[model samples]
Target: MASSPLKTICIYGAGALGGAIAAKLATGLGEQVTVSVVARGAHLEAIRAQGLRLWEAGADRPLVARMTATDNAAELPPQDLVITGLKGHQLTAAAPGIAGLLHSGTRVAMILNGVPWWYFHRDRQSGHAERQIEELDPNGELWRRIGPERVIGCVAYQGAEVINPGEVELSNNGRFILGEPSGENSVDIEAIATLLREAGVNISISPRIRDEIWSKLMGNAAFNPISALTRALMSDIMQNPALAAMVGDVMNEVKAVAESLGARIAISVEERLERSRQIGPVRTSTLQDLLAGKPLEITPLVGAVVSLAKLTGISTPTSATILALVTQLDRENMRAAE
Candidate 1:
């Protein structure tokens, strides 16, 4: 069968990950693809005034492409693919508008952290089908607006940050794992994966993406919240025996919950901890959220595990304690800001 021509790709958030993807697409795919970004505030303004700039290693490059950007989805044409690069909480806020940007065949790839809202639905044998994660989606907004079928799970393994408006600092890692909800290989999946690969991303189609999701979630579940609450970097968290053990406890609990759901983690807890240590002096997204005074993704990142533990008849005492401490700190931070 002949492959369908590539359609325009719109990256919704245009943050660090989004910007890197956009730059790579614009550079590699060129006119073969139309790239647009949806963003707001000073960043959006800067991108509009001056083209998006991407800096990697020691080189800076200004990508010259006529990309569309807007806060409103109504300002653009119906998208064939919409890559959501927003944080978990940001997705809920932008759900309604995002729904308006999609047509029937549109695929919405979620590239956020923690467990996705559609995690349970993708597991057929699991009893919790179409389960709504209230801590993440709250009020069933994302569940209703963006159906699970339209979702393509993406796990980003990159460390990029926006240094200033319109410019992003690219990190050493730039790989993305893509998978379908049904875990089947399809034309649409191949098309998107090929486009991403052509755009300079190390893209792979996984038969068991849920397993990969949980594996990554294990690290985020422990490192992110703990880092935020303690205001420590990854190296410090891994070096301190006590903190590392606390992280280990959280991971062990999460591993139980994941196994209960039939998602077997390939990596051991000790190996995963060593991997974190290898990442060196990296600041987790949770710590970044805390420092930026943005809302921390505690509910989806940690609370969802607690909810899953309840569903699976498992206990997660350490995770529960950490969740409590982080929740308190987030609330206090919000209160002080208010």
Candidate 2:
């Protein structure tokens, strides 16, 4: 679909990251390219009423952009490119609504954290070809509905949040990496990357998307759950000698699992840890979710790691313990919120 025109785009689950991206696209892309966001509750109403406002990282003022904001994706027309900013736990419920915005050649670019639902699709070397990742998708909902064939892998590197209804705040000048599961520099990937670039998004198109997923998973699997459990930021966790050492163990284990599955993580565990530590005092997604009383996105970040470790016959004691603890934390936190 190289010749495919990206005239219409939708941001599914326009929370923090999605809202930030949508705000940029709406203001950056002119009348020629229409950007719409699918949000819910008070956020949607605020966007409808006062437009989506974004405060760039380190900015004093917010940039407001007016575009289509709706609760139901069916209310909008079929989109050409749908970039999802939904968290791990929200996709199943939003799958149908997301599907409603798809046509024949629509590409669903998932800018989610941790392992994606389509991680096993077309990834034969993982020795789990087309196998269901029940940790990420307990049912076959995402796989059956939004077939892996239509997915465009995206790894987000920045932080964004919905500070208030209809307002998004950026933690940094975040960038995104996009690729296809088949590792092809296909037309769809190029088109989407170019469109995002045109909208002032720092984008990179990579062929080894699975490798990228594993690399990012290192931090998500380790720092996120640990941070939530301890209520500390990445820097804080890495500063303590014992916690930092535990994080290193988790990253190494995750690396072993990825290599066993045929994905190469180029960097060493120490380097990854140092890089994460340098990111300073930013709160991890898991930590933020915990403090906000939202559902903890556990499976994709850590549970999936344990599931894969078992598949690869690799021992991940630290990761396993963290997973068990975080899983229960999610349940108890959710219940308490209720």
Candidate 3:
């Protein structure tokens, strides 16, 4: 099949990060590309009424990017690029909807945290050989419906939040690390990078994207759960002696497991923790989800680590305990909401 001209883009889950991307692309592209969002509820309503709004730090006013917004993906035509910003647990349920927005040349970018569902799909060097991550995709719904071949691995380093129904505030303008699973500098990957760069977004293409994924996960697996469990900020977690040490332990375990599975950790545990500490007093996405009464990405962030540890004979005592507690918290909180 011929490569797509790459004009159309659909952001599957237009919450914080997705909203930022959509707003930037739609506004910066200036009719060059057609950008749309799949959003629902009050957020969807707000976007439909007033367009997607974004407020980056230091900006005097928010950026209102006029674009199409829909709750149903089936309503839209086949897209050239589908960027999925959904949480790990949410991806499975949204898989079929995402499929409704694709064509043969469509590429799906998974801009998510922790270990992605398609982590083992085409990376044969891991010796996992297309094995499904049980925690992230237990039913194989995502793998079967979305297909790993369409995935463009992405590691997003930005922090943003939905302050209101349709308004998102960016904490930092971070770049996205994108790659292809086949380890080839394919046309699809470069095209996506070119589009993102043209929109004033920083992007880096890597052959060893799995290494970048592991490097990003090292901080998230520790910080996200801890933030939710303690209601602490990034600065708080880094400054507190007890919490800092605990995250360090979890980082070490994650590093071991990743190295065992053929992923190279980019930095030391101390360096990772220090870098996190340097960030401002910001609430993590997990903590934000907990406060919003939304489902936490526990299974993907922490539970997945424990599962991998058992597989690789890596002892993750700290990670195991944190996973258990957060799992219970998620269950009890959801049960009470009902």
The prediction achieving the highest lDDT against the true structure is 3
Instruction: State the lDDT of candidate 1 residue by residue for 1-338, as single tens digits.
Output: 23435577788998888887887777778677788889989989888888778776466555544477788877888788989988887888899878887888999888977788878666764666666677777788888898888999999888888889888886575678898877888788899998888777889998777888888889899999999988999899989999999989988998899899888798999888877778778788789879878778887789889988998999999999988999999998888778
lDDT per residue (tens digit) for residues 1-338 in model 3: 22337889999999999999999999888878889999999999999999889998779899999898999999899999999888988998898899888888899999989888888877956799798886688788888888999999999999899999999998887889999987789988988998888888889999988898888889899999999999999899889999999999998999998998999876899888778778999999999999999988998788888898899899999999999899898998788777
For candidate 2, the C-alpha RMSD (Å) to the true structure equals: 1.8
Q: Which stretches of candidate 3 lie over 4 Å from their true place?
A: 1-4
The local lDDT score (0 to 100) that residue 90 gets in candidate 2 is 90
> Each prediction's Cα RMSD?
1.9, 1.8, 2.0
Error of 2 at 175 (Å): 1.2
Evaluate candidate 3 by giving its C-alpha RMSD to the native, one decimal: 2.0
- List TM-scores for all candidates, in order: 0.95, 0.96, 0.97
Question: What C-alpha lDDT do the candidate models reach, one value each?
Answer: 0.83, 0.88, 0.89
> Compared with the true structure, what per-residue lDDT tens digits does model 2 show for residues 163-262?
8999988988988899899899997898888778877899998888999999888888888899999999778888999999999999999999999999
Pairs in clash, predicted candidate 2 = none
Decoy 1 TM-score against native: 0.95
Candidate 3: the clashing residue pairs are none
The whole-model C-alpha lDDT of candidate 3 against the native structure comes to 0.89
lDDT of 2: 0.88
Q: Which candidate leads in TM-score?
A: 3
